[model samples]
Target: MNGVLAKYSLNTVCNEAGCPNKGECFTRGTATFLIMGKNCTRNCRFCKVAKAAPEELNPEEPLNIARAVREMNLRHTVITSVTRDDLPDGGAGHFASTIFEIRHLCPDVTIEVLIPDFQGDYVALKAVVDANPDIINHNVETVPGLYNAVRPMAVFERSLELLARVKERNGNLFTKSGFMVGLGEKEEDVIALLTALRNVGCDIITIGQYLQPSREHYEVVEYIHPGQFKKYEEIAQTMGFQYIASGPLVRSSYYAEDGFNYLKRANATAGGDV
Candidate 1:
């Protein structure tokens, strides 16, 4: 898998974000592709992806990603990118191009894109929505109270609006969002965050523990127990989320196909095209 990624000059959030589940996921012949560039424009303190001047958008990226997906014979593929505030559309057009190329080359593969907020640009967000990816994910990353400290440039409400807009534009597209725990958040904050996500008609949710990337980044406030993660899963399920994943090692795209597949089966059973 690493050889395939390198051969295509591709990047994966598994490596960029120091995801602990990379080894297992790669060994299983799957990875979440990171596009646009490795350098993020935003200086989110909790992220491990490099914060520097955003790199130029590679024109060949969409086709290269399609070729790589074909080479890997992936049934489900997840694509994410560094926040590209430098771009006029926050790289939304690039995301749409990638989604189109993937569908053109590998029509059977399911696609899920973890996208930036697009700086609350509804037009930019609509571009990706119009492409009609199987799932659209924009993570809140943390509770609203910690947004200033953990995600300074991000607006919690904007992220919610992004997710909400996905459904408003295309109700068939599964909307997903995620947040990290152990960020000195109280139980009420977590519950409130979940409620907000559900209120926006988010179909899938992921909850994970925050691991500080380096000494300079945000510190881990608490190591949440597995039981607590289970509790979160239960709460989200009760809130009518179609799918929920909660655990210490869970990332936005970890076992992502499971959620997509669950919705697929449900929709088929209900005689609706998903």
Candidate 2:
């Protein structure tokens, strides 16, 4: 995986965000492709990706990602990127290009894109929607209360609106959002967050513990147990989430293929679009 990614000069959130499952996923020949550039414009308190003035856009990145996907022989691929406020389109066009290249190179593979808020630019978001990926994910990252402390540059309501807009623009597209636990949020806060996501037509959710990336980053308020994760999973399931990935090490794209398959089955069973 390292050789392939290096050969293509591709980036991945699993490495940039310091995901715990990086080694395991890489060993299995899977990765969430990170596009646009490695430097993020926003300095989110909880994120580990470097914050700096990003370099010029790599025009060939889209094809490189497609080549890597084809070589990896992935049946399902998750693509994410750093927040590119520097770009006029917030890098939405680049995302579309990558999606189009993947479709052209590997027609049968399922593609999931975990995108940024595009700074609430609907036109930019629409560009990504027009590409028509199988799933569109925009993670809220944490409960509303933690926005100021953990995600100071982001708007909680705007994130929810982004997910809502994806469904409104294309009802057939599956929308997903995720948030972290152990951020000093109460149980009621978690329930409210889940309800809010569902209210906006979100179909899939991922809940995981917030492990501090470094001493300089946001401190871990607590270490949520497995039982608590299971409890949240049960609650989300009852709230009509087609699929939920809840565990200590479950990142937004973790076990994404399984979640995608489960959603397909659920939609088929309910006589909805697959």
Candidate 3:
């Protein structure tokens, strides 16, 4: 996995965050493409992307991603990137342009976009949605109490509202959100987070353990076990999430194609359009 990603010069949340699932995903011949630029404007304690001036937006990124999709022959794909707040459009237009290019090249593939909140700008969010991705995902990352320490630039309720807005605009689109669980969040707080997502119309939830990428990053308060993640899945099911993937190594885009598989199956069982 290490050797494979180096040559591609690709950006991935997995690599950027030191994701534990990297080896497994690479073996599966699946990869998440990070577009725009790697340098993020926001300095979150949990993220490892370098904080600096924005880099040049590669005009050929979409074409390169389309080429990778073809070479990987991926049946499903996840495309995500850093928070490019420096861009006037919040890089939403670039995100959509990549999606549409892939759609033209890979018509049968299921695509998922794990996106930023775009600073809660409705028009910025709408640009991505208008492209009609298979799933639109924006991670809540953590509960409200830890916002100042964990996600200073992002608002807790606003994150929920972003997912909610996706459903409000299109009921058929599957909405997903994820957050790390062990950064001082209580059991009650976890349940509350699940409830909030359901209340806001989120259909898929991913809960995973948080691992610090470097010594300077946010320390792991607790190493949650796989059992606890399973328990969270049980709770999420009760709270009405159609798809819940919770595990120590599960990422928001971790095995996301499987999530879409379950999504299609569930939709079919209910005689709903997929």
Error of 3 at 124 (Å): 1.1
TM-score, cand. 3: 0.95
Model 2, range 1-274, lDDT digits (tens) per residue? 9899999999999999999999889888889999988999998999999999897889999999999999999999999999999899999999999999999999999999999999999999999999999999999999999999999999999999999999999999999999999989999999999999999999999999999999999999999989999999999999999889999998999889999998888778989886
Model 3: worst 10 consecutive residues (lDDT sum): 1-10
Candidate scoring better on TM-score of 2 and 3: 2
lDDT of 1 by residue, 101-190 (tens): 999999999999999999999999999999989999999999999999998999998999998889999998999999999989999999
**C-alpha RMSD for every candidate:** 0.7, 0.8, 1.6
Where model 1 places Cα greater than 4 Å from the true spot, the runs are none
| Per-model TM values vs. the true structure | 0.99, 0.98, 0.95
Candidate 3 residues 94-185, lDDT tens each?
Answer: 99998998899988888899899888888988898889999999998998899899879888878887898888777788999999988999
In candidate 1, which residue pairs clash? none
